[model samples]
Target: MPRSIRYFVAPAAMALSMCATAVVAQSFSSSTFEIPKPERQTFVPAGTSCGSIVLTQSTSQSITAANSVSCNAGGLHSDNSYFRSFPLAADINVCEVQFGIETATGASGTQPVTVNLYSGTGAFPGTFPGSYTQIGTASLNVPDQAATIFPATVSGLATAGSNLVVEVFTPDGQTAGNSFFIGSNASGESAPSYLQAADCGVTSPATTGSIGFPGMNIVMNVVGNPGGPSLSVGSAQATLVDQCASNPGQANGVIEPGETVTVQVPISAAGGSFTGVVATLGIPAPAGITYVNSTSNIGSLADGNSATATFTVTADAGATCVTGFSLPINVTSNEGATASGSVASQIGESG
Candidate 1:
């Protein structure tokens, strides 16, 4: 979550010593026009290997010779972080994340790297290392062509104008013995990705295109449900139970005819947090029934959390076999999440 800041007097006289975790060395970035050519390599399909379409910038199978950019630190340095951004298709919870890297070999003596998920709020790689309050994080050990599926679940993250930003932090160590390259391709997702290495004169996140590699898209992917929020999260549900004062012991999930009853529908919340939740009648009561009270307060619910909602109604005494009745409910929260559903009930007059 942190690193040191150093002062560089000039760009030419780029030799500077960094404080804290940053290594002491001259800053470096490369941008030579290399012909992008593929030479028979195992293809890494961007398909949903984790049961859902994984998100990624590069869709090409093999890394082109000219596209295979350096791992994390473009040059010899300690503590370098890279960022990539993408817009999620509405309510989809991220199930997995994977970023590619060439893996440091020989003298590099690399440390484990972390994949972090941050709330998307401005144009990506613009000025944000793109990390404010991280939503989820996972660490992976590097291999020669490390493309580890980061094991983490991210939810409730709506695209706040900006796309979801991913931070890949590499602790290349201060020694700068040797450096590895983060996996990259010529796919060029969005502005060639961004770098946040302060020692490299990149105090703020600047596009790699600005530094040097103008044709690079940090090889990273996100996988998850594209249809909606996870079944286990970000959803609301309810079950109706009837409570009657006159019929003691007869109060069992059904609405009895001619009885004034309180229909208690417990509203449940999951995924993101919810507050000031309330339920209101979405449709008029069916024929032969009258609504005494239609609004019910659900209160507050923390992430993966709570419920309590109810309404009162009465049935006509002469109504027999009151079927085809539906109670449509509209549940809303302070955050503006509106979920609507209805429960159908059939009433039988007591014999």
Candidate 2:
């Protein structure tokens, strides 16, 4: 994955620089918004050419703006614009936008493109509240054989369930023969349909409305603290394999005197709240089973994260046979929360 983080603090503020960097690193996350191909067809202006706009599943998860319409003049003001809305599940600091451009055939020239973020008023392709900011810009050259990813750093705060309109603008002043399309994917689908302006100029005017395309995939990377950390542990299992046996295949939930068994468990964190988690296996000494360094340290975890821990147990050579022995597992976090579970281990003579 191509991961990138952007700090919103200004460079002149030296005192808060380190703190900002740390918070930004911890808050890094991403989301991809996508939509399926539309049942109807739509058209959009690309410089001097008009292209049929439709969502295609064949080209990965991206929407295709096929530039087929051509114009006689090359220098005319032929502006093209495409817009998509992204809904946030929780409050987040918008950081980056990643996209790609594909040009099959067209004049060889540089196409000036700009990406902007706007707060939607309401409904699909809702009204822009005039509170919009330009996040980034790029100059795309013609004859791009492969899909090229363009990543831009954007700084803004959005409320939960809020719609953030992402607009891509291809202005005039470039070669009219320069015809191409923007690439998108259907990895993550969400609300608020994709919109575009066919013959509209550099900016997406208020009059521009929603198109036939409902879902278009445009990936957005954001950073935020969802909530306090949560933790969980998967089921624990024990493995016993005779070292001297020819096959030495592993046995489940069974062990013998003087033999060793390994227990494995998986731990996870939800809401990214807890840090410095540790797992320990608690076995009574009187049971004749020794805990040989059976502790796993899981440094830290963010929300929706996970880790694994393993424990080793050894049975005494002269120990009495035990059936269905219960071994306790204790997982503690620095945040003052502890989770407990148990696994069964059996020690008996095998024919």
Best by lDDT: 1
Candidate 2 lDDT over 107-198, as tens digits, reads 54344456666654365343553544333232333343324444433323455666656666555533454443455444344433243433
TM-score of each: 0.49, 0.35
Question: Per-prediction count of colliding residue pairs?
Answer: 8, 15
Runs in model 1 with CA error above 4 Å? Answer: 1-24, 29-51, 59-61, 65-76, 106-110, 126-132, 144-156, 159-162, 175-178, 227-351
Instruction: Please report, as a residue range, the 10-residue window in candidate 1 with the lowest summed lDDT.
Output: 229-238
> Which pairs clash inside model 1?
55-222, 70-181, 70-182, 71-180, 71-181, 71-182, 72-182, 100-183
Instruction: Write down the lDDT of every candidate, Cα atoms only.
Output: 0.55, 0.45
